[model samples]
Target: MLSDMRALTHRVRLDRRMTWTALLVLAVATLVAIPFDWFGMWVNCLPDGGCQFARNGMLWYWPAASFLAYAAIAVLYVRAARARGLGTRVLPYAITGAVTSLAFPAAWVALDAYFSDHPYPEGPLPYWWFVLDRLVMPWGMIGISLLVLAWLERNPALLAFAAGYLALVLLVLPMGDGFGSPHFGIRLGMALPQLIVGVVLLLGAFGFRRAARRPR
Candidate 1:
């Protein structure tokens, strides 16, 4: 029985270590990638048509792809931690991420159907839809941030991440293209901070999971 207990303790320790490693990796990745993305360093393409308006522009594709990747990683890591009997506090946050993961496709289809007519309907649907859809990404991030705040009060990285994104959103609102503009579509220069924020939330989710797994 003591041997079995020792083995179980070892497994738990290993799992805890793995959780910490994942959190560190996620945090470092977020910090490293965000600067490159925010400053437009990772891409060789200029904002000029030669790059920005190209058929397959890296600037446009990068953020869209990266956000999706972040969503996937966050959901998977949270679920994995929960399955291992760790980070139960993060389950709701994981569900939020999962829903946000689907928001992209759902928004795409819904927007296509709603805006099929050039003039669109003469109602509040467009306005509300525009506001709600745009809010979905932020909502997911906020959920994760709150979860981190609740569970890992010592680690302020996720809170900082959420705050930075919120600040960016406030800064960009005045400069934002109207609802008629391709604001909903992939616009890297416009959405870089948001993509980075999504990434931070993802990384923070893992960090929160790590904190949750630690023995009191």
Candidate 2:
């Protein structure tokens, strides 16, 4: 019974930690990513977007969200460690999260350097790289983070949201040609994942708290 109580206590603490994490991710996604790139082309590209086109063309907007995310993550790990009364396994998770978030953008930078002098003729292609690079890659990062968090907490609400978000991504992925379909379809598709995530976190915040407390 003592062991079980400790486990529940730890789980509850995690639920609390992740509840805030969910809110943070959503906030940055809305405030940073949305206002910066209202076109939906660059939606949810990472955990930080500075609410001002924080990605490639406009990285200057990043310091705002970056500070918040890092600070919250620091507080999250500290509180989680204290609550668990154990060594900080959460450190690894936090580091891994940061690495995963940076994976795409970092790779893009390195590859861009290598391909700068490509042999192929380099006129701007009429098509946009938004769907695959900007949309899918960042969404992929967000999805991975969500799934990992859900698995850790074993929270049904988080899992359900993650599943639904991925399904929405798949449904929208093929809407624009190069990926096929109408242009508006592409935009709407791009918009929906971010929108749905925000709505889910808002409506299901309580559900997340309740479900996470159970901590299967």
Candidate 3:
């Protein structure tokens, strides 16, 4: 029994295609859960902040669109990894990206529930929840940055472009108002550093890919 378990672990570790497929499935499942509010049980409000919107509208479609976009990218990553022979390292990075991507949305639901009753206008909720929410952004950024870094290690040029894209969004977008405003400069601050890291990672990945392609 122990030997069987070991063998299974070994197989999973070595099977890059299977690992990527699992990552893709995990990403899809996380995406599906977003609209349903399954990450944490709660009601969703419309942009007008009226009665909960029906499940079929933009509330569902927008997130679904986002999911589809990420899913497509994940598929492409899997294909590229396979062609390039990336193994278990890809699995860790993929998992990190998946978990990181889900963090903010998941925390938003919980924070909403906490804040709904207490109201930010009233005093803040217990300091812990506030701290947790603050932590989520950094934690999520790190996870995603790691994934980007991993990709950069595999394909520098592609990741450099992605980093540039992230930089552009950070610089140009009117994400929010002031420091107190949720949209303020926080995301830009977090993203800019990550993009720089991503550039370095891109160089590494490009080197790795080139080395992999060279004949012995």
On TM-score, the candidate that comes out on top is 2
Model-by-model lDDT, in order? 0.46, 0.52, 0.43
Q: After superposition, how far is residue 62 of candidate 2 from its true place, in Å?
A: 5.5
- Error in Å for residue 169 of model 1: 2.8
TM-score (C-alpha, index-matched) for candidate 1: 0.39
Where does candidate 1 stray beyond 4 Å? Answer: 1-88, 118-133, 137-164, 170-216
Flag the better candidate by lDDT, 2 or 3.
2
- Per-residue alpha-carbon lDDT of model 2 for 73-181, expressed as tens digits? 6577567657766433345445545655565666567656776777644886434454345433554555666677666655666778777766555445443223233
TM-score, one value per model: 0.39, 0.55, 0.37
Minimal lDDT window, size 10, model 1: 49-58
**Better-scoring candidate (TM-score), 1 or 3:** 1
In model 3, residue pairs whose N, Cα or C atoms come closer than 3 Å (at least 3 residues apart or on different chains), thus clashing, are 153-205, 154-205, 156-202
Backbone atom clashes (below 3 Å) for every candidate: 0, 4, 3
Q: By lDDT, who's the top model here?
A: 2
Model 2 ranges with Cα > 4 A deviation: 1-17, 38-71, 80-88, 110-136, 173-197, 200-206, 210-216
lDDT of 2: 0.52
Q: lDDT tens digits, residues 1-216, model 1?
A: 999998886566445323333334334444454444344433233445232222123234334543554455456556766788865234444445445545645655566677676666685565555445445443333444344533432335445645554554433332232323332322444445545554554665576566667775
